[model samples]
Target: MAIRRALISVSDKTGIVEFARELAAAGVQIISTGGTHSLLEKEGIPVIGISEVTGFPEIMDGRVKTLHPAVHSGLLAVRDNEEHQRAIRELGLDYIDLVVVNLYPFAATIAKPDVTYEDAIENIDIGGPTMLRSAAKNHAFVTVVVDAADYEGVLGEIKQGGDTSLDTRKRLAAKVFRHTGAYDALIGDYLSKLGGDPLPERYTVTYEKVQDLRYGENPHQRAAFYRRPLASEGNVTTAEQLHGKELSYNNINDANAALAIVKEFSEPAVVAVKHMNPCGVGVGADIHEAYQKAYAADPTSIFGGIVAANRMIGEETAQLLSEIFLEIILAPDYTPEALDILSRKKNIRLLRTGELASAEGRKSDWVVTSVEGGMVVQESDVHSISEADLKVVTERQPTAEEMKQLLFGWKVVKHVKSNAILLAKDDRTVGVGAGQMNRVGAARIAIEQAGEQAKGAALASDAFFPMGDTVELAAKAGITAIIQPGGSIKDEESIRAANEHGIAMVFTGVRHFKH
Candidate 1:
């Protein structure tokens, strides 16, 4: 079909002027409204106002405009159908060959720090989406353009032959639908969140693709990274890769996990992660000492793991890290000597994430997991278990030093996958068992790894003990103190086991089950 009339309306006026001018120069009539009309006319591009086409003034803050038969019938009419053509002629409605529209800045408006509900509602576009949907639905005869990025190619196709190919039109139509879907999803998500609804009647989420990874968790799997438009501060989603290769899917996931765990500490801390669980974590007087303790915790698992540091990486830490085979190293800042030493590894990815902040005391958010047919959304288990939150459940009370280790192990266990167990001593994790089928299994792994080190260490379980077996096993492995969420019906059995072995056990009453 030959192009004759085109409508242009956009809130993002990116390349609209030059695009509209090209359309006008190509002998196509241009119809525009509001800001677009003013912009095109100011640029000396001949344009017909929407009021002229609809034979009605824009009313109700321009909301009543473009909802007329003149726009929709023209866009929806099928050219080859004789009845459709006859109906348009009888109604004196001209066919709109192309529609170029972008919606209101609802997302931007809501992103403002102090935006009100009324301000956000007013920015919702009605006419723009109506025209876009109408034209895109009839893409076989009418072309639709929603993104400014497509302007050059669309204008080129029109300039060459006054017609866009069916394939191009179809692609553009798909883009229009996707754009509108994301726009509406953002609106829905923002409104639902503002209303303080934990789980709305409908869940709507929109993400912009960041990049396609070289591979997923495995080489054969394909994967991509996406981010929410309004990403919060100090998240791995906003991390900047300072050096080395593009991140693989596993690298991104592991790095994110490492970052989150490291941020849990307020002191000089370091965490090494593998397969979404921390292999080693430590807090020390300095960054170098933290790295040394963390590396010593699990040397084998630290190989090829993603490492994160809460403090700036000094030369000594950099030199030590360079000795290992790491996939990624992240820090808020790195000394010049440290960067120079680490950059020698050709394949290692270095990221500079500025000032990792603890989410403590913030409004808790949701953690979503996808099932086969649906998703499970629940409040994030960001709850922490400090010394004050613990209740001494055993007859023997924990010593001051044991209490400190117990709190440290408690924080580490929260980041581990469910059925998790962590053994800690002197503010450093000696061993961690994650994502095991049973609590006893996790306990065995952690205790065996700790071996002689477990003699005076504290053990933290992510959840309540199902039976006395784990406590018995810990006692035999020489674990002196234990911390867990105590709510299981068989809690008495575990408490009896602890008391029998003279082990100090504390219950936080708060569970941290990560999966």
Candidate 2:
């Protein structure tokens, strides 16, 4: 179809002037609503107001502007159908060939801390979505444009071929539907929150396509990355890739896990992650020593895992990390020599996650998981258990050194799966039993893995022990003090077992269930 009429309405007016000028030069009539019409008129572009087409002035706070039949009829009219063409001519409606519309800034508005509920509701664009969906529905006859970034390419294609291609129209139509759907999802989520529903009446998620991966978890499976609608200001996903090969699916997953753990520390720290679990984590006076201690803690597991450092990667630290076969290394900055040495590795993925720590006192959002037909969403387990939060439940209290081991084990236990138990001594994890069928099984596996190291080590459980058997087994393995989230009904029996074994026990009141 030849370009004839173009309808333009947008809250974001970037590049609109030049786009309007080019369309006018090509003999295309421009019809726009309130703000867009005024903008085009100021630039000396001949433009007809939407009110002129609809025979009604914009009413009710401009909400009733483009919802009329004339606007949609022109967009939906089938060029080759006699009945459709007859109805348009009989109703005195002009055929609209192109629609350039972008919705209001609902996401940006809601991001403000002091934004009122009424202000957010007012920014919701009803007419824009209506026009976009109508034009997209008739994409065979009308081309729809939602993003300003697509304007240049579309205009270039139209200028080269004297008309937009049918394939281009259809592809743009799909983008239009996705755009409107995302907008609706945001609105629904906000309304659901206001109504105090635990879960949204409908799932409203928006993701922007990031990249096409080489493959998924396996080579045969296809994969691509789509980021959440709003980019987290200083998150790993928004990090810059300084050098190295493109990240694989598993690399991104492990890198994210490493960042999550490293973000917990305020001091100079380094964390090595393997298979979504931390192999080693250390805090030191300098990043070099932190990386050294972390690597030495579990040299075997750090072989091909992801490494994340809270501080910048120095040349000395980079030299130590280069000795290992790591899949990815991430930090805020890298020294020139450090980047040079790390770049020598052909397949290592290096990322510069500027400021990996969350802003002061900012709470991290919940992580949501989807399974089968249901969704699970809960607050992030980023809250650290402080010494003040631990309450001694048994007759004996934990000694000073055992308290440090208890805190270290508590941090490690949060990353493990449910029915999880971790045994640690002197800030190093001795053994871990994660995702077992029962708590007793978890305790047995942890103790067996620890072997002789289980003696005098402190234990941490993600949740309360339902029975006394776990404590009995821990005592048999020579455990000293245990820390757990105590809320079970049989908690008294577990406390009695700990007292009988002269093992100090503390309840944190908070659970760190990872499943």
Candidate 3:
């Protein structure tokens, strides 16, 4: 097929003028609609108005333009079919060999701080996607273009020959559908969210590629990072990497885990994470104190771990952090001296999430995990509890200091894997046992890690103890107070064990289970 006629309509008029000029210079007739026509006329280029092609003026504010039978017949007609050509001839329709179109600025419009719902709904383009899809469906005969960056190459191919190659047309056609599909998915998601249904009957999400990682979990696997457009503030994807080498798969996962833990605290806090679990967490009067306490909590696991802080990092804290080998340091911001000192470590990833780190939460409360054939989507474990929410169910009441430590411990335990136990002292985690097979085993690991520190520490369990065995072991380790959901069938036995050991037991009535 020869490139005798081209349709040009675009919301983003980046290189359309030059592209259209080249097309016209190549003796290809240009047909455009609305703003594109005015632009081409003002640029002194000979172009046919869309009204002339459709034989009808645009109505309903140009929304009905190019949606008539003339445009569809030209795009859908099979060039080599005698019957189709006869129908075209009888209907007085000509072939549109090329289509260059892009959808409206729906994504950017919705991202604005104060955009109205009417404005966002009005920006959805109906005719543009229909035209693109029509042209793409007949890709064997029609050449479609959606991206501005492809203008030069596409024009080169057309200039070299009379028409684009079949391979190029197929590739561009695939791109057109993907572009239009993503556009429709965005609109659907926006409307579904406005409908106030968190889990609709059908859910669709689209992401843009951020970068290709060095590798996945292992050297043999390939991986790339994709982030949702318009992600909420203070997200790991939204964090700025100021210095260091590119992030690895494990680095991003560990960093995200650290961020989740740090986001739970409003005051100065630090969380050191390893293998997608928090090894140490601490909250203090200042960042330096918090960092020191976190480092002291688990010195062995702190090596080459990801550290997230909710406050600005300064020179003093940087000096302490420089003593250890950490894979990453994420904070709200960094002082000049702190950045200078940390940037020297060429392989350490430094992430700045801005002030939102102090108050930022996830965009949605949904967590999705893949299984063999499908995914299981459930609400995220964002359950929170206050001091007032804790019910003292045992004879012994926790001291004010113990209450603070238990709250801090509760925050950290939620982020740990199931069968999790965290021993906290002085608002810092003395030890954490995660992903164990049984409650007693998890308690033993936590107690052994805490060692002498477990004597007066507060133990926080992600779920109720299946039996009194965990409490018996905690009593032997001298754990003074305990926090658990207290919903187990053996809850009475566990409460009796707490009373016998003179331990303070509080029931949260809420469980935080992370697998």
lDDT of 3: 0.92
- Choose 2 or 3, whichever is better by TM-score: 3
Give the lDDT of residue 370 in candidate 3. 74
The numbered model that scores best in lDDT is 3
Write model 2 residue lDDT over 1-515, tens digit each, in one string: 78889999999999999998999988889999888889999999999998888999999989899999999899888889999999988988888899999999999998788999999989999999999999999998888999889889889977887678889999999999989988888788777877877365556667777899999989999998777766664466788888888888888888888887777767787888888877777767889977876776667778999999989998898999888898899998898999999999888888988876532345757578889988888766668867998999999999999998898788778887778998887666777787888989988988887789899999999999998999999999999999999999999999999999999999999888876
The TM-scores of all predictions, comma-separated, are 0.96, 0.89, 0.96
Identify the candidate with maximal TM-score.
Answer: 3
Q: Which segments of model 2 are wrong by more than 4 Å?
A: 38-44, 59-62, 160-162, 335-337, 357-364, 438-453, 466-469, 487-497
lDDT of 3 by residue, 265-285 (tens): 988999999999998888899
**Backbone clashes (count) for model 1:** 0
Summing lDDT over every window of 10 consecutive residues in candidate 1, give the lowest-scoring window: 358-367
Ranking by lDDT: 3, 1, 2
For model 1, how does the per-residue alpha-carbon lDDT over 1-515 read when each residue is reduced to its tens digit? 78999999999999899899888889999999998999999999999999999999999888899999988999999999999999998999899999999999998998899999999999999999999999999999999999989999998998888899999999999999999999999888887778887589888777899998888878898899998888766667888888998988888889889987887788898999999999999999999999998998999999999999988998889999999899999999899999999999999999999888764643466767899999988886567756888899999999999999998888788999989999999778998988999999999999888878888899999999999999999999889999999999999999999999999999999888787
* Each prediction's RMSD to truth: 1.7, 3.0, 1.6
Q: What are the Cα lDDT values of the candidates?
A: 0.90, 0.86, 0.92
